[model samples]
Target chain A: MKIGQFEKINDFEWRLPRETQPGMRVPVVVFASERMLNEALQDRSLEQAANAAALPGLRGNVCVMPDVHQGYGFPIGGVAAADYETGVISPGAIGYDINCGVRLLCSTLPLQDVKTAITDFTAALYHACPSGVGGRGIVALKARELKAVCEQGSGWALKNGYATAGDIETTEDSGCMEGADMEAVSSRALERGVDQAGSLGAGNHFIEIDLVAEVFDSAAALAMGIHQGNLALQIHSGSRGFGHQICTDFVQKFQTVARKYQIDLPDRELVCAPLKSPEGQQYLAAMRCAANYAFCNRQLLGHSARMVFERFFPGAHLLNVYDLAHNIGKIESHQFGGEKINVCVHRKGATRAFGPDHPALPARFQKTGQPVLVPGSMGTESWVLAGTAAAMEKSCGSCSHGAGRVLSRTQAKHQIRGDELRSRLMAEGIYVQAGSLGGLAEEAPQAYKDINAVIACIEGAGLGRRIARLTPLAVIKG
Target chain B: MDANRPFSGFAEVPHTADIALDVFAPNLEELFINAAKGLYHILGIRKGTKEVENIHISMVAEDREGLMVSLLNELLFHAANNQAGEFISLEINEYQLEADLLMLEKTGQQKEVKAATFNDLVIVQDAEGFHTRIVFDV
Candidate 1:
């Protein structure tokens, strides 16, 4: 509950021993600076992390990133690996926005080349991509088409001419998770998915036009198609209402399932079902449907942005850099304790940062490692980092998602006026377009921790290595 | 909106990453109604000019918390479909809940809430009334 209670493992590593918390199966390993550790103690994040460690059949330790903050049941920037055979899977751990992730598309056009058209470009993108509360997508899907999206993910996008081969190749898991059974999804979730394939829902989701400010590693940047002074686009969203419904359905159902299994948890939100149980398998199958839906959602969004890019600048192309999910549950083989074993890695508000030579990565990134896109708060610097081999050993190939919230939404809204925040951003040469001023105020940069410090902690812990830093030229938020 | 109502009201609470509301009521039905109003407030929803349509909802759950979550999620489902429900009448008995609502089209909404989470959701009844805190994933 306090910073002084943790056992200091190193400058950026601290451990809350299993003995510190009753019923904890493993220690809670937190990566943070002394200041960050204190900041975490300000909230219930540490306690949530300890709760996560108590989950059944946990392996290694519950790894909490520096951007950690209190989430529903588990800490936001938390990673826990459970033995594939005996562990339990909880819907709350993966978050409501199933594959809530980030996608980056780098273009060769330099910022100076598009300086005059920045406003128009931003407006065009806003029109191309639907955003805000209850914003319908570009195309409404029938039930059959929605089913295809649930199973094929970006592959469906490719067939429908909304995605490029390169885009699918660069996406994590090639944009599809296997074993997503359509029958497993509820009709309500299907209805929600039918009309929200490409819409960017409100609350901290955005499409940003960024200028590559600096390149830390030229080779890695080149591999990721990021160049200094050039422009890039970032899409941050998820499976929309579809994922929300699936999670809600499962979390509700799991309540009874947990009782049936006699699994006692500190928080009701942490209710889980055994991995091999029929209920767990059904949830997994349904969760994958939402995951694939999110992958296709990002692809469609990228396609729309690409269309706007082509219309504005003739012959210009938006290349998919790398797309990865921050919130997900995946079966991955890792070196735990001594031998390599398969475990279900649940990353909630965390990104998979597979280092170089990991077999899961594509051949193109075999040497450079997976690109981890860490977007800062609006008007702040976003960073592109490469996964490190050290991450595989220490943090279950996971890193912080973004600058975690330090203030509540109500606090942010009360402190910062939306119009004033917009004016300040405009003065800084960062063009802004938001659905609602109140929503804009809730995501003010002041409400978040220092992103630079978060990245420094990641680097300090060798979880990831910085390759490029990006500054926003324009931002579109919902 | 009903903060002045004796023994039944709702207020926003501070949460790091989501929207949380503290609600209190004299009974289960009042608690459910206050929770619905609190949800709409968080969403910043404004009523549309369209005519209201009447609808009824019936649900059965395992316990009081389950009943509460089911009621809120039912409201959210309608909200997601562009309808905002105004409670007309409500009834509750143990684990079952039934309500009549006047549904109106939602023309303006500022924020989007994903789901209502059960994190630390404990409805407690004391000498004054019943009180609980609900955290919504936004």
Candidate 2:
């Protein structure tokens, strides 16, 4: 696995042809600059992407984004589609936290109006948004109630007065997947889900308040309710323990099932079962339950955030911008080889950036394309982009999630002490609320690659169009 | 704290987006116990002053790797879902692990690890007895 072995498709695209890997069924198309590609070569991201290409009945080339990094079995920014009839669905490929995604909410208040209230506002947000390690959620639900949440997603949030009507409309799949089977979820997973319904779990998840720093395209930015100097909130969370348990249960189950089907996987973590198999259906049902749970989870957090804004600034209001999932396996129809075919697209650290006019997009966004939320690492410029028609033909309607980690937790700690990092960030006018200083150290901005460059690569690869850039003013992390 | 002292069984390993731990123990039982302690350490579990009762946990896996994941996940389950319990003792065989977790009031937990992943996970025996690497999704 070397950069020299890859064929440069363009400035932002590289390819490891089928001949480059032993069992690769299709080529591994990497969307990155030469520098980013070299960085990816330092890890096993390309190798994992090739392994993903080796999966059974894979349709399109395994696509790796510019912000690529080594993940468990597949590259973090890898996207692969497998035939619905003959493909395989692996829990490992979809990641442990199902539907771990980001939501952007633009506020009516401007930063200058709230500048003096940031400290109190951030503290209020931290208090309202229950975060950190211990409790994943504040609302405890009974088995029956939990089942309803799993089925209805953000709808349950709306019924419970935790979400607005516009919130559901702006969310992916309207914040609920249709096929979530309550019976498919295990008791252990349900127990894990009970207490963590509206909580923000630790590790890379956060709540950030930012102002629309720079607008690349005012039309698209206005379409997304992102205006320069306006406050926007980014809620990055997932299904919490609920999704983790679902993935854990399925990954463990698929271990034996993969052997049962005699699937020759390069890595054990890449273990999978046929998409049409009993095991696959069971996992998909359970996964959808987790996905829906995540959708509801973020909505509840949004409710908490809204409460903070209302309490802090009397007239502050918010409108849901967009909510999108970064890690998921979805059955979608795509133009493949001149035919419309159904394929299960597995996105681990990738996002669905369906182009404008895509039938699946919400009516309001059809003209502007789906809003792509890329919340960069703490204290950096996050991005809001629009999915393009070019993305649909190239990268399976996918784009980079964010600036992927470049340093390990231990390495990050060795580089800077958490308290010092916090103080430094505070001195720079960025309010910080973290559960643990050590945890904060691991998420330092330098631990990640250059996000602006990653976004540029995404644009260069024609996966997305620049819309708005956000600069962090305050952050609450668990 | 004395009971926890002199117990250097595992060390934190570097992972990009998750928590990874490397456990080294003389046998299967120690490996299981050390792995649990490693997870609790990562979670920053704080034990209460008084113990209430003994909670028994049992898990079975097809292999050592699976067994290790099950035991760690079992600890995570109790940590996340249950209001009480800190692992105090662990006993293990080839394929099964049994442990007694102490439950008490006012127990505090800092981090909740979601699950143990099988990504590049392996338990290999060597001259140092047995060593294993586990990745946790937080």
Candidate 3:
């Protein structure tokens, strides 16, 4: 009968005090506008955030971005910094969609030109890119080859002639995370990833043709090589079954090890061991493999996008603007209370928005902050945001991933008709190559919060600043 | 029994007053019922339970896969955060696979709606178990 109590901190922040829930090691900080907060509270993500704070070895605060929503263990759009030496690693925190991320590619083509051949373009992309259940890709690797991918990530794609150096430069961690152990990865996971290396699986994953619709920060936009009306390709996917298997393997393995270490956990799903512990090391190793796999996955997809574009506009240039990972955990150094602590930053359904000057960002754009690419759902608008100093100083350089889902897929499907949605998309002059009409209905543009609003909130909250807006001209979905 | 009798055994269908098991011949209906039963099983809905509070729950999916994702999300909602009211079961006002799901319901007398974890979901195929984590925030 009563509502969960949450204290308003400021216009953009709220706190769930530790005392409100048992086993809370620190408070939970939520970044949201009041209007967004009302929608956020409609679900249990805030509660999940509070639950995550109770996690052992959690330092600072459990941070939930403006796009917060309920997820498996750690809420999507949730960030938690765990002590490297003693804290635990949750597969739930990293998510089944390990490094399930977004990549933006800028092209020399203009929106009007692309719009004229939307149908042809969508069909070409759909045929070129495999999607949906059993979505087999064009690339395949043997065990040793797959291991190389795990180690080199996007770099592997480039070396194998699947990607270019430019694609690597624009990617987070340059498309690689060192210390990946193939032996640590299960064979089943390896096999699952082998044929699926470059495929785009179903459920919200899409390859969209978009045009820069708006620009909020021209200088940042220029730095990122984005311009109004310039066509772009956005790819959204992850490690697929390989990543899922890794999470499953580690969650079970970590749970056993957690008990061995006598780690007291409020939730079993939050099972983890000290980062330096054998269990922790194994997870980080395996997670790195999955992370790299995801990077490679996107890189290969980028190559596919390039091929698709090349077919349409021969000799045209399509450079990757950036690739950002939304679900991951990494060991990074941060200054907390004036002391630099090496913390394992867990970002679930959240983007790492490292500000300008952070050494981790690419050298050229180091002064312009990391490019935070937020992909909107099919038929909607996407935004390019630059990381902010405040985000670096406060939230461990994180920002909202996208316009969080506002409607359930069922609700979207029920309220919308796939045929009607197709007609509507056609009416908007956008061509869609959908695997299923029902699936199309579920991804209706209305199922999400306004991207403009969400992007505005991120900029308003000082987590990130908008650079450019992307409007879909054509979409290919699994 | 006809070929389509026990619906495709994936999900349970919604019943009036209490959760009922519908024997359908195809997986389509089975999956639909499975969705309903999955929700009912989490809520443990019963008509005799007093209506303590009213909760409006709506879910969206991009397709059948997304529908499964959303259905799992509703189950997660019931399990982890259903404390605001009792566990009055779900009334499937509308249900379509890969399309949409609408549930008209009330908060029942159950004191707790448990948070369903991936570990709680056991997928058995050919006597082998595969673990999966479902993201169900619609």
Tell me, by lDDT, which candidate is best: 1
Cα-based lDDT at residue A232, candidate 1: 95
Interface RMSDs of the predictions, in order, are 0.7, 1.7, 13.9
Badly placed stretches (over 4 Å) of model 1 are: B1-6, B49-52
Worst 10 residues of 3 chain A by lDDT: A1-10
Q: For candidate 1, give the docking quality class from DockQ.
A: high
For residues A1-478, write the lDDT of model 1, one tens digit per residue: 8877799989999999999978899999999999999999998999999998888988999999999998899889999998889998999999999999999999979888879899999999999999998778977999999999999999999999999999999999999999999898999999899988999888999999999999999988998889899889999999999999999999999999998988888888888999889998999999999999999999999999999998998877889999999989998999987899888899999999999999999988999999999999989999999999999999999999999999999899999999999999999999999988988999999999999999999999999999999999999998
Report the lDDT tens digits of candidate 3 across residue range A1-478: 0124678877788778888887889988878877888878876667778778877788788888887766655788899998887777777777877898999999877767656676787788888888874446768888888889999999888888998877888899999998998878887678677788898876678898888888887777777888787888899988887887787667656656777888766655677777888778888999999999999998888898788888888877788899989989999988788888889999998999999898888876787899998887678888888898999777989998987777765567679998999999889878888876866876788877777777767877799987788888888877
Return the candidate ranking by lDDT, descending: 1, 2, 3
Lowest lDDT 10-residue stretch of candidate 1 chain B: B1-10
Best by DockQ: 1
RMSD of each candidate relative to the true structure: 1.5, 2.7, 12.1
lDDT by residue (B11-100, candidate 1, tens digit) is 998999998999999887899999999999998888896856899999898888888888888888988888898888999988888899
Q: Candidate 3's fnat?
A: 0.08
Stretches of model 2 off by over 4 angstroms after superposition: A136-138, B1-8, B82-94, B98-106
Where does candidate 3 stray beyond 4 Å?
Answer: A1-4, B1-138
Tens-digit per-residue lDDT, B40-61, candidate 3? 5434444333433455555442
User: If both were scored by DockQ, which would come out higher, candidate 2 or candidate 3?
Assistant: 2
